[model samples]
Target chain A: MDLTFTERENAFRAECRAWLERHVPKESLGSGDTREGFARHLEWERELFDAGWAAVSWPKEYGGREASLFEWLIFEEEYYRAGAPNRVTQNGIFLLAPTLFEFGTEEQKARILRPMARGDVTWGQGWSEPNAGSDLASLRSTARRVEGGWLLSGQKTWCTRGAFCDMAYGLFRTDPAQKRHHGLTYFMFPLHGEGVTVRGVDRLDGDEGFAELFLDELFVPDRDVIGEVNQGWYVAMATTSSERGLTLRSPGRFMATASRLVDLYGRYRASAEPALRDAVIDAWIDAEAYRWYTFQTVTHMVDGQDVGASSSLNKVFWSEMDVRTHETALALIGDRLELDIDHDAPESAGDAVDEGAWMRGFEFALAGPIYAGTNEIQRNIIAERVLGLPRK
Target chain B: MRFAFTEDQLLLRDTVRGLLARECPPDVVRSAWEARSGRAPSVWAKLAEAGVTAMTLSEASGGLGMDELDLALVLEEAGYAGLPDPLVETVAVGAPLLEAVGTAAQKERWLDAAAAGDALIAVGFEGQPFVPHAAVAAVALLHRGGDLYAVPREELPLEPQVSVDRSRPIARVDYAPDARHRVDAGDRAALDAAVGVAFDRAAWATSCVLLGLTRRMLDLAVQYAKDREQFGKPIGAQQAIKHHLATALIRQELARPLVYRAAWSLAHRDSVRDHGAHVSMAKVHAANAARHVAKTALQVHGAIGYTIEHDLHLFQKRAWALAAMYGDVGFHRARVGAATLPD
Candidate 1:
């Protein structure tokens, strides 16, 4: 029940704080929506890798520090505190890599994980198809067996960073005889392969950050099969669990946003309405709640305990918290919500301070409820799996 | 660096949960509530036998000398059982307050009796209305002018006030910290510190009370949703019913950490002021979880949940009672505001 970190933990924190103090970029990373911005972010991830900070919790053999979960949590807190650039390789590094650690063969690991950790390649998720948005298992995407490999042919929409990513990993129907979750297989392939076409989608960010991939018999070699064939559903759960749960949305982002919200609120609070003040207070407490809850979770993982239904509950909380926190900031900002990230409205240029990012954050928060297995789906999981409610 | 409880504490939780499940079932709780005294003395005795009351009291005072975190787990279990007894008030607020600030004679009189479950002591913080267990308690611990006091229940005139939760016997007492009964100490500073301990301990326990009740309520709701068929299928199959219960699950999950963190903060004495906000957050979220789950449970159950025969209202009323006690959501939110917000 202790909250105080050990001297060793404190020393680790000090080392991390010192490294971030020096390495964080001096300027914004330009939203990483542009190709140049993405490359810069990739270079920043490389810097992190060189310093053994890219995936602090990953095993050292895979090019990580092999830090404890608590250390990883601490690193994340310091990373956000120091205003470090966003990780352009998060999807590959956090989601896919854990599955790799769990199920990938030695040969696949030797070939993929090191380069993935080094940021030499970036990856995007290709799980959702045009007809399989929420009910992903009902996907019509097919992969027929070929000589020494499989051929992938289908459409994958809402592919985050799909417009430019070099690689993707997703589920494919491996056997036509079995249905639903039975006959699927996990596969990873080059996004720029012979039969793949990526078209940029108009996303809320007004950038080509998201794209739709059209696959015309894309050949994926047998070596790229992640887990056992006809068991992609099982393998994909590991990645989705990581996605919706803890790996991606570290407390650092929430803590940073919360502090910014408080600092922003303080500027106009003296003249603001009291309800608005209470709303800000509520927002702050929710962030603090998330922060402390993560500590407990890291403790559970460290103690070798299963988080169980908490992943679903955490998904509902942080997504909603993101929305509420952003809304409160927008309410305080009043009318600056119209400014885009590259806003050049001269009259407000001196004070913008990237009010546009907050606007962008508000839009992104809306996506939180929609993506990562929509909150409704998450709630069903909680109700059914966690609460033991009856399934339809 | 460990954030989770020790194996012993985990065992203590499981034991209390098991004891309450067998000895303090819903029927026993109802019987105790419906009885003339509206409290289960046997349940209180069972808890005292289980060492819940004596855990935080000093061994010199014939107690276990455990800490707040230890007792918090037991209190959470009690809340889960919706136990209709004054044990939580007796131990968390009464004994701790007595040991911290009561005169030597006061400790000899109440603390030992409380540890043995031979007596009950109700606490009434300043500005609070209903004094719980005042009807059955032998004494009352109150605060006024920043000083703590203990007066025999026989000395104060009490006007009986019926509570929605029948097991909680409440009343408005007619007494203002009489000097003769004042538990005197060094000076105003020591008095304030002791009062803070009593206040924080009681408020934090009330938060646990809400948490336990919320879990019970959510469980009941989920069970009913699974069995109650609507339009030829279980209601839980419907997205609306599942969503309602899921939201309740979310509230319970979010609030559980706040409660534990508050327990940890107060147990470690990590910044009295920050801990104040910590407990306040727990209190606020507990009330939110309890009230929200109660409402959602009723909605999911339709007419059946609204009946007195049903178990939902019992937990609902108890949750609301605990929430209204110490401080409601708005009260603690303001306390949190004072603690965290700048002047």
Candidate 2:
């Protein structure tokens, strides 16, 4: 029941706050999904890596501080509060790294993690395909055995930053005799490898945020296989849990957006609708509730409890909350929300009230529910797995 | 930062939950509906014997001297059982208010009796018109002109009011202000501060109760969905019913942590900044969660939940009653709105 941070935790918070205050870029970077934006974000990631702030929760051997989960959360809160650049390495760092740590071999860890942390390599997730989404186990990608490696041949769509990412990790069918979740193997391979083609897709924000990968006998060596063959479904479940739970969408991100919404409300209070005030307040409360909820979840994790199916609940809540928070911000900003305030424009530069950010944020928040397993899928998981409802 | 209940706190909650399961089941709640007293006194006595009635009282007052965090889970159990009593008023709000602001003479006379379960204290804040259990209380603490007055039940005139949840018998108390009835005669500033904190405690406790009631309603709906058959399968097999319950569970799961954090904030108010906002956040979230669960539970239950014979209505009604008690969702949201979006 102790809610206050320990003296040590508070000290860590102070250190993070000071570091973030000094190091956060004076100007916002472009969206990390684009090629140019991705390169710009790599610079920021390098700064974080150089300062040992890139992967605070990872082991020191992996170029991290080995910070406690609580410290990691504090770091996230401070990072978001400072309006720091979005983590371009989030796919590799938050989602893939946990699974890698759990399943990667000593050699694999040595070769992969440090470089990934340093932004020398960036990763994209290759889970969703054209025919496989909510029912992910039905993916048709195959990994036929070859000499010293496997030949992968399939199409992976909705690959986040796939057009520019150095590598990708995904599940592929390894046994033609088996179906569904069976006979699948987790594999990581370079996007520039032989017989691999990547096409960028324009997203809702009109950015090249997604990519479609066409693999025609792409070779991935045995050394790149993560976890045991045919057990990739179970291993990939761990990665999905990270994506759907605490690792990917921490409460600090929403809290930061909620705080910005409050400031926006303050600026528009005179002409804002009274109902908008309640929405703004509800957004703040939702963020605060999410923060405490994460704290409770983190406490349980620290106490040696597995998050398991409950991660579905977290995914559903925060995704919906993120959408509502941004929607509220857009509503408060009124007609100015229509303005396409270009970030690169000199007049809009350094302006705190960037109306376009809210629109862009709203577009981004809409994807929260769709990605990391759609809310519909997450709800079904919660119903059947968590609540023990009938699958039929 | 550990945001969880201690073993002792959980034990105390379990003890009360077990007592309520045995003594204040759905039948007991039903019995309170038509009973003249509108309460289960034996269950209250059992809770008092378990030291739940005096959990927040000072040690000198023959109590455990615990804080709101200790009583949170217990009050939640009370909400789960739909316990028809003034436990929140007497223990969580009234007794603590007296301990904080009552004079030496006042504490000497009522505190011991309150801790011993020999007396029931009903509280009515200024904004709220009806005082719950005022007719049955040993004393009624009425707010008047920013001051508090403790009038003996015998001296207080009460007009009984019918409520949607029959287990909660509320009344409007009519009492003239007098020097003898003034509980805050010692220090006006202290009384004002204590009264403010008392309201926060009331809201936080009520939110805990609402969460408990919500859990109860959701469980009932889930169980019923599993048992009832429709279109050749159990209704729970249907995605519509399953999704409804799942959504309700999500709301409850998220709201519970906020309520717990509010308990922590109230317990550490001296060191916590803007603690009232924390309480308001809990109240709003809990109230909304309870309301949503109640609606979804009824929807899942179909026609049975609408009937008075079903047990779901008992909890649903209790949730509705308590969701608006202390402060409704809108009221608490406004409080939060002011704090976060202040002019």
Candidate 3:
């Protein structure tokens, strides 16, 4: 077993490092989650896509470089290290794209993948209804079979990027007769379609990254169905796996942030209290461990190995790690931590980079533990499914 | 770039696991604790017959020359079994240290016997003077100011000291300054490198063993949870108990990759610079996993785990002792911190 990268991997690292160095923006895009900042973030996505750097893990035929998993990880590390803008199309690029590649029709692949890859259309996930957060199977959204299409009716809450995304894919109970994971279908429908209405969850920043969907007979053609009818459970499970697995939070993101945390520590190293120092150190250790752990996981995936239960384990671990890291960064900054800013802050309104990026990041990281699936649910998965314990 | 073990190494782990399950079950560990020797001779013989002791020894030293990863896998199984020998210290740390730095004659004298399973070898890092199993072992590896020495058992007087882990007989090796055979390990730089490799490998093995022990505790606790009923049902059904085991599983899963990767880095040797840092990281993470798992496992098992009548203490004690071996949590964490800082 070897830990060091091969010459080819090192070369890929060099290429990615060079590209990110050349293309990363000269100024911070205020807050990528905000409505005003998304255009610039989209521009960054176009820049990366134009350079053939975006979606490096997708097959080359699908507008990616067909890079190895390790190489893709290298790309992520370089992407985060260069302080590049966040991927505005993450939900589409990371989640829907992979699921589509796996289960999409040739026509579906032909029509959707390129635009998704090019950031022409953004996709938001439509899981987690008002009645269903952790108990996701309790969702009451329905899709009725029609002569020409399926008519969707119900509400989906916590739709990330819903206010802005062009489309969403979610599970709907196709047969009201069958309950609890049966007779359901996965379908993709446009948010701007005729019968759809969306209201952004009001926030101080007005970014409206998450929204609530109200559907009344939203028409989605049968061609928009993902996988078999009544098999949305399996398909949605795959999507959740993507949400938890390496696709969403790669080790590079943690490593890059952790490195920044270490640099921040160097700034406060002189008068830093031991408790603060330890928190900083804990952040670094966990981040480093996560990085190495991802490498091991990549090796396994590349060898066609399965990492069952570890997917949930990874979600719990890295999400919590992300929160701890951001918290430590905030604490280490001392009084600088007080500058909690929204986009309209005086500094944010100008050409200058706004401060409180860590604070913003810390606040956003709170969603990591809660979203995708809560840690409580993940722990249950580990206990019953992985450990062979009796189900509650 | 494979992080998983090869078939051969995996088979070695399985073989040892199967043998230990049959030969050295918890009952053997319990009985061995009460016995005077406490070494569990039959189980040691079975491990030796399986060639577990000779894994890290070089072919030139009358033994198979597997790398650190191979030996680490075997040691992990031994740990999972909670075997009471100094086998981890013997094969992973002691043999490898002598092979790397010992004089040809020094290896011929010490390595052959250790590999043959006719004798056990115990190691004493300078700071932690307790060489486990030193009492009835054939030899002792003791370190002083700047030199690492392999003194015969007859040369040094052993003062027996009881530890919380009854099966592991700890001792204070009473060695005077002028009394030992100095195995020539070149200059200060060479000696330091040898010592560093030995200590790090030992620490890495100790962490792997601790991980194994913690997993055993987790397994035992989970089984008991399924069997022992409370509240008119199996307590395992309770969210409190499920969450307990779940958190333990998380800690183990998280620490596992670090342990294996550190083993890989150590096995890779010259291919990686400053590999000791990974070893320390593994030690620190594994120690934390062990601590969390043991405490939670005991809580899940309730009163039964608190008694010596049950076998939970066997693994719990070994985990706590092994965490303190080489260096404890704070020491290794500080080492990692020091490694991180820019010099």
Candidate 4:
């Protein structure tokens, strides 16, 4: 098996590395969860879209370069290596876009994909509700048959960046007679529609990163429904896999963090605990392992094998590794862990530590195991589905 | 880039796996513990006939001319069977080392026999205290003062050491390096470098075997969890047991790619530092996976797993023994750290 990148792939990497180096801001952008920060992130998204970098794996008709998955992975590596701002439109681009590509009608694709890629209409996930999480099929949201479309009514909580997003897509029970996983229809609706209200919720990091959506008979046209009605569970499972697997959390992200952690350890090597040193090394190795694992996965996908339940294993690993990488960085930061470093600080600040970025990163990493399906539920899926363990 | 074994490689792996299933079952492994030679010669001969022993040797030397990447899965199959032989020592390490540095006369004397599985060559690295299969081998290659010596087994003084897994017989070979025994008489420095790369190949091979042993332990645990019932249901129904096996499966799945990547690095002959780091990473991860899976398998099997009467102990002991060989987790981790972390 050949592991070295081809000449063309290396060229693609060089092109991406050059673009990211030139376009990425010198200073980190503000949290995309905040209103002003969302606007700023939107500008970066537009720049990426203009440069055909918004959706590298998507068809060119939709503002993308129609790059291969290997190229997409290369772009991600360059993206994170350049320390680019977090994608404020990730829920739409990463999670929903794959489903849309798979299940969206031609008309839906034409209307949604281009604007979505261009950041004209940002999208947030509306899957998890107050009652439905790990057991997502038990969602209480309903979509009643209407004259032209469906009338949706329910509460969708933890809609990441939903407070500012223009639209969302989720599963709704279309026929109450059928129990869990049945009778659900996937629908996309505008957040500011006639019967919808969005309220921001403060997250652990004190950012309005999550929103609660109250849908009161919101009218969604039949055109917005993805895939077949009553088969929404299947449609949404596609999105869940994307969220929990490769699209959302690429190995490049963790490798970048691991690199930073190594640098941080070097800065504190004189005073860092020996255990912390080992932790840094272990985290680095884990990241490297994840990178190769993803390559293996892409190889299989290229060979026509489906990821299926094995993505849960990927989720469990990267999510935990993300936490460990950040935790190690925080440990190296020592008592200064709680310092709220100013994002707007000058170039020379606090011995070039980036101050509280590690703390903020730690907070962000904390959400990984919780979101994209909790690690516990992923473990169950792995045991029963992947390993064929008996499920009582 | 393709990061997977080719069809031929996989076919070869399956052939070895099927052969081992028939010839080196648990009973054979059990018999090796009591055998005077601590080996199953029948299985070794079958592997030779199947071209496994000659895979890494050159075609000019009556061998397959395959590289580490081709034999990786085959090595894993060997580990899966817990075969009581010096396949890794002779095939993965010995033949290749001889092919690379052995004189033409040396190749004529031992390489052809090794490729035919008629002669077994055991290897002992400098830092390692014990030489595996030294008592049964026709010749033992020992490292001293950075020079490799090929001493005939008859001339070598072997002190047998009882391993936790008796199927794997290891020993201390006390042999003074002599001019006659020195294999790399032409270029000592180049020989030293070749020996260093051979050590990396050995480590990578051991990692592949560790992965196979880990998978075997996990499979036993999963099967046991399904069969062994408690509280009116199979114990596998319990979340604790399921989660334990699930975690082990995750480790196995993740560690495998690292091992495969190491095989690629060795096959491609990447920069010495890069390949060295890659091999160490593979060793560290595979060792961790084997260690964790062994514990989980034992815990899931309860007291039965502890007994020699049960088959689980065979793989568990093999995993434990191999996990510490070549380089343990901490040793490999430090190697990776040295390559990765800033000085």
Please give, for residues A105-218, the per-residue lDDT of candidate 3 as tens digits: 999988998888788887889998999889889989999889888999999998887888789999999988898988888999999968899988854434578899999999
* lDDT for each candidate structure: 0.84, 0.89, 0.84, 0.89
lDDT of 2 by residue, A1-392 (tens): 89989999999999999999999988767788878788989999999999999999999999999899999999999999999989989999998899989998999999999999999999999999899988899999999999999999999999999999999999999998998999999999888967899999999886798999999999888999999988899999889999999999888899899999898888888988878988999999999999999999999999998878999999999999999988888887877787664535424653333788888889999999999999888888888888888887
What is the TM-score of candidate 4? 0.98
* Better candidate number, 1 or 3, judged by DockQ: 1
User: Which residue pairs in candidate 2 collide?
Assistant: none
Model 4 lDDT tens row, A1-392: 88878999999999999999899997656778887788889999999999999999998889898898899999999999989989988999999999988988899899999899889999999999998988899999999998989999999999999999999999999999999999999999999969999999999887888999999999998999999999999998998999999999898898899999998888899999878888998998899889999998999999999889989999999999988888888888888888764545424356433747788788989999899899899998999998888889
Model 2 TM-score relative to the real fold: 0.98
- CAPRI rating of model 1: medium
Which DockQ values do the candidates obtain, in the order shown?
0.73, 0.84, 0.65, 0.86
Tens-place lDDT per residue, model 1, A1-392, is: 77888887899899999999998988777766556678878889889999999998887888888788888888988998898988889899989999999999999888888789888988999999988988999988889999999999889888888787899999989898998988999999888959999987868777678889899999999999998999999999999999988897988888888878787787768666878888888887888788788888888988888987678889889999999999988888777667666623323444555577788889888999988899999998988898888788
Worst 10 residues of 3 chain A by lDDT: A346-355
Chain A fold similarity by TM-score, each prediction: 0.96, 0.98, 0.96, 0.97
| Model 4 residue B267 lDDT score | 86
| Model 3, residue pairs in steric clash | none
Residue pairs in candidate 4 whose N, alpha carbon or C atoms collide under 3 angstroms: none
lDDT string for model 1 (B18-76, tens) is: 98998888998888677836677677778778888787788988999887788777888
**Residue A166 alpha-carbon offset, candidate 3, angstroms:** 1.1
Tens digits of lDDT, candidate 2, B1-343: 9987888988888888898999998888898987847679899889888988878888877789899889899989999999888888999999988887777888888888899888899998997989989988888888888889888888888889998888778887766788798875467787888899999999999999999999999989888988898898989988888789889999999999999999999998999988999999999999999999999999999898899989998898888888899989889999888787767
lDDT of model 1, residue B163: 83
Candidate 1 ranges beyond 4 A from true positions:
A343-349, B270-273
Q: Which digits, one per residue and each the tens of the lDDT, describe model 4 over residues B51-148?
A: 88888899988899998889899889988999878778898999989888877777888998999989998999988989989999988888887888
